[model samples]
Target: MSGGENSSRLIDVVLDESIGRSTPDVEHERAVAIFDLIEENAFHPVGDEGGGPYRLNLSLADSRLVLKVTREDGGDVVTHILSLTPFRRIVKDYFLICESYYQAIRSATPSQIEAIDMGRRGLHNEGSQTLMDRLSGKIEVDFDTARRLFTLVCVLHWRG
Candidate 1:
């Protein structure tokens, strides 16, 4: 897959997790935030009319992430989440972060790329073969790397 495609896939997995078993603490407000935003089917004009279709409700202690779903032709629907790393571990009194990391095989910054380029060393691991195979050798995987990637798959498959 292309870089943008991979990035979006990663984001989807994270957002799917947030929709279901969302760290418990942040789930409630995140749900409520979505509710308020879509209080009516006629919900129109974003953010009190000044900005776009989204606005921060500071009194409500909001986050910029907006999760939306819509059905075209009243058929099967899908979720649309807007964020730059938007999902959080919790959104209780204060928003807590969801931590995720990746080691790129390419296009990573020069200084850091070399370290990851060497890949996970010390008899520890390499990347995942499944992804690599699917990518026609463009991607790679070692057992440890597959284990790391399982988190992404698990989150995407989770249901509330």
Candidate 2:
């Protein structure tokens, strides 16, 4: 469970209680992100916290993103509070592009949709990279894992 295996990944992930209602697509995106993240990810907490199989709870509070991690058995691990200020611009751009992508899918030509999707993926990658940079020294995760986590963060910010 130590070296390089999926054993160090998150076993469960939950959103805050007040997430309220979301569009079907939004809910689907959240579900897939969590499922894919837990299924295959490399997440190793820094310091003497010990290796995981961890559970993560994501929430937004007062313009901050709260990541509460716990052991598989529910023991406390670490709570990382990150100010959302740095992510504001990127998230906004991502959402706006995503909306365009979705709309393009409905009526635009194939090439148009593809172009919008490419832009969407680029923004998504940028957001993921920012997340990795922000989480550096606090938690370790691979690029794909960070991308999925970024999706969850966007979902959490949907109402804001």
Candidate 3:
């Protein structure tokens, strides 16, 4: 990719293990989201002219989501702490729908699985939008990047 492309993307993402551990399924989701995020994303901290492919460390503290951004060389950029209140409902619903979808994969018909999957994706999208809105003026990210970040957020929230 070009220099500009590299400057606005994430090169690495780390989830704070102290927050919690994930189940196998959740682990898979976290891994995939991180992979996808690093592969391509638009992440530019507002007013940051560091021109860097950033590193992100996600963690939860006191029911709040903490986003720590740093330059590729580990220089501090910015950290955003956001309330989890707005995402509680959507994350809960998304978890329910995801469970249904996973269960459906074992026995339900393709149509049924597709329907559940649709709801799961819808919730995911809603959560992504909420994240983008919450990060407004703090961090700028495209919709797809927001989606992946939302997935990571959900992973951090997962207790099992």
Among these predictions, the greatest lDDT belongs to 3
lDDT of 3 by residue, 85-122 (tens): 99999999988888798799999999999888888999
**Each candidate: what lDDT?**
0.29, 0.84, 0.88
Error of 2 at 128 (Å): 0.2
Error of 2 at 153 (Å): 0.7
How many pairs of residues in model 1 come into backbone collision?
A: 9
Where is model 3 poorest over a 10-residue stretch in terms of lDDT?
17-26
Report RMSD for candidate 2: 2.3
TM-score of 1: 0.22
In TM-score terms, candidate 2 sits at 0.88
Report the lDDT tens digits of candidate 2 across residue range 1-160: 4554655789899988756658786788788878888877778777734667899988778888889999888989899998889889999999899889878989999999999999999999999999999999999999989998888888766753
Clash pairs of candidate 3? none
Q: Score candidate 2 by lDDT.
A: 0.84
lDDT (Cα, tens digit) per residue for candidate 1, span 22-78: 555455534543443233212112212221222222110122223232222222123
- Which is the better candidate, 1 or 2, if ranked by lDDT? 2
Candidate 3's C-alpha runs over 4 A off are none
Error of 1 at 38 (Å): 1.7
